[model samples]
Target: MTASTPGGRRVRIALQLQPQHAEYRQIRDTVLRAEDLGVDVIFNWDHFFPLHGDPDGKHFECWTMLGAWAEQTERVEIGALVTCNSYRNPELLADMARTVDHMSGGRLILGIGAGWFQKDYDQFGYEFGTPGRRIARLAADLPRIRARLAAGNPAPTRDIPILVGGGGERKTLRVVAEHADIWHSFSDLETLRRKSAILDEHGAAIGRDTARAVERSVAPHGEPEQAGEALVAAGATLLAIGVSGPDHDLTRLARWIAWRDAQG
Candidate 1:
């Protein structure tokens, strides 16, 4: 029921428990149920306001909740599905991730992205920069983050895996090629293939062996029996299922876990 099977192949399925319209207690209970159900990773999103449902719905801050999750779950990697780069200083973010990494005994995945969601910026008093500017900032900040992580007091429990989500291609894929331990894609099949090749090309241009080095990540499109094969064939080993708040449905999660198990 861990990530790895008896056949030596690993099936890494993640549940992104959307932090919207749900109380902390419901979220906490779901986290426990998910770990018990054998998800390889559990994720929450980085947003100050609800992305759906009521505009003024209940929501929790991302990093603080991650600190709680680090203590709550004994297994399953915990992180934001993608934290906004523009929200915090890169060095500070690095230290927070390191602290949570230690808190979770090294089970943190630093999933990051260029800032989106205009309302979050507007409400939280952060800049709502252009896409180019945002990504440029993320690109510039990654090295600083790495340097800070390297210089931290105790250092990370392990090389914390960086999962870079986008807002891909021209700028983002290149960043992923250079720095990311996992490259996430939620695009369709053709997009997945095309972008993946571009990601490889970026890796090659930089001499980084990206296609082999970065783990390909994707969310399931349909039934796991059907979607899983194609996704794996397309080189996505990580399946991140989005579970919206108020329900945090696990029916599909159970189905995918069943599919993953049958792979053995």
Candidate 2:
């Protein structure tokens, strides 16, 4: 179902539990704590190496941690913030998501993107293709991923929502308009409004009603509560905030949760 209700577009808060510079125990604990505090979704980035601080510091794999999150929490939706499409075969990824869907009793959101990060490719031996090539690959693979999800033996417990993360006006937004259940981005209010219009045009050309087909998502962490309020005003219903590890601070997370509760 859409995250909206009769009252208004529901304000969803997701915590991107960055899987670096911490013990697995710490990450697990943060997941539990975020759930306990009533975060709507829990996300972890997919990467082989750390995204910040000490390039060679501790890091964790994405999907494996998601499987654990599927088992650990009962209420919150768990997923990669946005999985890199180049990392795994689409069919295998579908099966993996299906397994996690069952494990979490259908509390899973499949967030995928065309892979970036050259280091992930260099160290892992994946080809760091041109941006166009990567986008083209993503455009081709999304259909296969959807088909596999449908064809799986057990199938996903529900129509697992596909959250496509990007804001490219040309190819990415077109793919999002055509297939995504959620459109996620880092754009601010005016940019979101402008690109959302492009998304609408793309949707119209494809005979899809983007307004109902996709929910807007934003990571409004720079100013937590205020940024979140502004983003919601700008048509973003899902606000994800990034929280780094080790100590796993919840100060800003708490502020957003408070703001979300206040909205209701």
The residue-by-residue lDDT of candidate 2 on 174-246, one tens digit each, is: 9999889999986777888899889999999999999767898988846654576567766788888898867
- For candidate 1, give the lDDT of residue 142: 95
Report lDDT (Cα) of residue 22, candidate 2: 96
Predicted candidate 2, C-alpha RMSD: 2.2
TM-score of every candidate relative to the true structure: 0.96, 0.95
Instruction: Point out the worst 10-residue segment of candidate 2 by lDDT.
Output: 1-10
In model 2, the number of clashes is 0
| lDDT of residue 247 for candidate 2 | 86
The whole-model lDDT of each prediction reads 0.88, 0.88
